[model samples]
Target: MKALMTLALVSTMAAGLAGCVVAPNSGSIYTSRQAQNEQTVRIATVESVREVRIDKGNSGTGALTGAALGGLAGSTVGGGNGSVAAGILGAVAGGLAGDNVEANMKRHAGVEITVRLDSGELRAITQDADELFRPGERVRLLSDGRKTRVTH
Candidate 1:
């Protein structure tokens, strides 16, 4: 009766440990505080834009430990052939538990933005650099210190 109780407990614990994995969140926005040259006719371009990143939470460590403990318990249950079979079964069960745990903790989401600038000549002025600039859009600028603020 005692051995049966122990086995039940071990199996329960192992089953509980199989899930873990945090999903990643979406991407985010980047900005620059640098000022453009005064009086420059800056040209802006929509380079790239994307979403925000999601947060990935940590999965519990209980799963791996539980698997190991369960395996040990299984091995101790029977002698010879029974013991070997129990250990193998325990490992398989434990691995599954760990995989599930990882999956649960998995995070999913990421975004990327890329901008490019144009090559030209104009006046030096801090005009509307990122005019129609959407959130998450990465703007790039190429300047000759003479004319435009090229935003890609």
Candidate 2:
């Protein structure tokens, strides 16, 4: 009776422990800047940029799978006295292995952009200029034989 009770308790605890591992978390942020100046006059250029990402370790699914397999293997080993201890230890080891596998599988994506401008002289003529730039809008430059302008 005592042995059966012990075995039942061990099995229940092992099953419940399978879901103990947590999944990893990750995130990213982006930033950019632009400035305009008067033509034919000396202009100084300055720029700043930064990017950040956060990540956490551990994967829940892999941990549970590993724990179940490890517990089963441990239960198979040792006959009466040692089986329970072996099962508990195996579950813990399997959980950590599963977490490592999950962490390795997790991926974090990032992006970077750089622009360089050359120093040149330009003529400032009075003409109609348009400043129709807005956030979340795509801008492209097109060049024909001689002139380049923003595409619509």
The 10-residue segment of model 2 with minimum total lDDT is 26-35
Query: How much is the lDDT of residue 110 in candidate 2?
Result: 22
For model 2, the stretches where C-alpha displacement exceeds 4 angstroms are 1-59, 112-152
Model 1: CA > 4 A from native: 1-46, 50-70, 73-80, 103-106, 117-152
**Candidate 2 residue-wise lDDT, 1-152, digit = tens:** 54674575566546545544433221111112111321132222212112323233443766766676676667768878698888888888887886676665553422121111234322111111232323233333232333233322
In candidate 1, residue 104 scores what lDDT?
52
Specify the highest-lDDT model's number.
1
Overall local distance difference test of candidate 2:
0.44
| Candidate 2 backbone overlaps, count | 0
Cα error of candidate 1 at position 48, Å: 3.6
